[model samples]
Target: MGVDGVFVAEPVSNVLGGLACLLTMYVTVYRRLGR
Candidate 1:
């Protein structure tokens, strides 16, 4: 159960991290263009 949990969590965390990175990049670009 512990191993399974880790496997499931790893992908979810990775996806969330990726999305956060994309969002940060998008915001930075948007602000730069806005100026």
Candidate 2:
């Protein structure tokens, strides 16, 4: 990752993973609240 072109894909993967995690947490909380 040291100045290599491979580092370009980092942001995309991070955004995707973050969105997935956020959605999962939202669903979990909603289910627990029963709303």
Question: How accurate locally, in lDDT, is each candidate?
Answer: 0.98, 0.88
lDDT leader: 1
How much does each candidate deviate from the true structure in C-alpha RMSD?
0.9, 3.1
- Model 2 misses residue 4 by how many Å? 7.8
Candidate 2 — which residues are off by over 4 angstroms?
1-5
> Model 1 over residues 1-35: C-alpha lDDT tens digits?
59999999999999999999999999999999999
| TM-score computed on alpha carbons, candidate 2 | 0.71
Clashes of each: 0, 0
Clashes counted in candidate 2 amount to 0
How do the residues 1-35 of candidate 2 rate in per-residue lDDT, one tens digit apiece? 56555676788889999999999999999999996
Candidate 1 ranges beyond 4 A from true positions: none
